[model samples]
Target: MIRWTSSRALPSVDDVILLAGFGLGLSLIVAIGAQNAFVLRQGVRREHVGVVVAVCAASDAVLYIVGGAGLGALVEAHPGFVTAARWAGAVVVIAYGALAARRALRGGEELVAATDGAVPDAGRRLRPVLLTALALTWLNPHVYLDTVVLQGALAASYGDDRWWFTAGAVLSSVVWFVALGYGARSAAPLLRRPGAWRVVDGVIALVMVAVAVSLVAGA
Candidate 1:
């Protein structure tokens, strides 16, 4: 009988750093589900984009660390954890969907135009972005899997030196959120028109509803 021993292969320094960061960042974000849309909307408004990004990045960092620390195993093992997350996520998504439906139901005539020189309502500016960001982060199961389980698992793939991988992943989250928040700001010109704002709001509502439906269906 021939016995085969598994050799632990370590990823190259460059590869580990790049892959870990890229994987973590992309996993947490890069999806046009609920969060990204909200962020983009806020960015266009030039209101509280920084706050939204900060919250999102911070949330990701915490969750990623917890997941990397093997907390994901607990989530996976405990049926209650999944149940709670799913229910919580479902409720959040539904709420967003309802908001979107309301916007969609409102005709284009009622839409506000985005004018660069004109000031926006302060309350409107902050509430939507913050609420959307929170909903995206809290409601989506994929977000957990991406940051916590998947990112952590990727970091752990480095055998013994998993910290290096995790560092890269964490960095990616920061960079991506900052970029996303800032990038959205650049589109303010296009988003500021009343018609444009209405359209954007309508789209957001549709996406929210669709995502909510998906969550319920999956559940």
Candidate 2:
């Protein structure tokens, strides 16, 4: 079992832990992935960006809480679980990367978002959009690795201040998702160009593959 330090060694709160959590959380969450891509797309299209952001942020918080509370300890106890998750995550990420690469090569022409304030008639309904957001957030095995296993283990290192670490991580998730979801609108004009979207997709594909490779190598 993973041993945590006693609360007696910690103050009521620690700024260092909080700052560390914030920085680490931001670094991990900022990576390019399907969730980020979907959020950006929804933001650019101006279709239920709020809902998508909320769902993502909330889901992350839950995962972080689970990790920080005790799941990290459980994960540390079971190396086999980590191995299984790593391989599974790699496979999923690779598949997603291939799809992204395909889109970059052949689907660029359909990348335009509705420029007007009004949602396009063909725009996805709220239910489907929310469901997609949930799927992308939860279905990705990397999420568990990053939030539950990695983040949890890291937080445990902080001893009694683990929850504070988690709070900072949660805050980072909220800030990042909100910015990515809302700030994406500013890039809408540029993304309207098929070439620009192609570039974005290509970058996403590269990122996905890189992450997958990293997981495999680390495992």
Candidate 3:
């Protein structure tokens, strides 16, 4: 996955493991969640996009590093942490979902691209945005259940090349977050119409509530 193979240089078995990690990580992280929805909203607003993307990518990289380093085992041993996170995540996600639903119903929100003739909305202060991003990432139980636990178990299947697998997964996180955040920014202009923005918010609301429901049901 890192590079194409040539006749002179065949790919090693570990390379295959790395590629597997990259593919699996991307597939898992791309799922709809409160965090991803918030990232997209912030991206559309062009508010702290760089910081949000960095926080997400760096957090995922940390999870992958720890997952491969036995932190997964520790997390598994303590079920209470997961339980608490699940409840907390559900609460926060539900609240966010309700807010999004209200905005969608009200239909006042509209996108203003930086390229627009007038100044675009600057959005909220940096501190609140930063805190919200952090909370959405760390408080979510999926970060532990799906990422650390499930991915770590899969990484173990690589045996001696587990770290390579972890590295590839980490790379996927960085690439996905960068693409999602900046990609949304590029599409901000498409949401200039209030109707389009309302649709985006409605979609985000559904995703957030869906995630919350999943967490509650699983718990």
Ranking of candidates on lDDT, top first: 2, 3, 1
Candidate 1: the clashing residue pairs are: 100-205, 112-194, 113-193, 113-194, 114-192, 114-193, 114-194
lDDT tens string, model 3, 1-219?
Answer: 599667687788778667757765765675546787777777766788899999999999988887776743544566455556556656766776787788778886654432344233466688998999899989999788656766665554444566887888898899988887878766656655677757766776776676567557756
Winner on lDDT between 1 and 3 is 3
Instruction: Return the TM-score for each candidate structure.
Output: 0.53, 0.60, 0.61
The top-ranked prediction according to lDDT is 2
Stretches of candidate 2 exceeding 4 Å from the true structure: 1-13, 71-123, 188-219
Candidate models: Cα lDDT each: 0.58, 0.74, 0.70
The local lDDT score (0 to 100) that residue 79 gets in candidate 3 is 43
Ranking by TM-score: 3, 2, 1
How far residue 110's Cα lies from its native spot in candidate 2, in Å, is 17
Count of clashes, each model? 7, 0, 0
Q: Which should have the higher TM-score, number 1 or number 3?
A: 3
lDDT string for model 2 (18-120, tens) is 7657755765676556787778777777788889999999999999999887844654676455566557756766776787688779854432434435343
In candidate 1, clashing pairs total 7
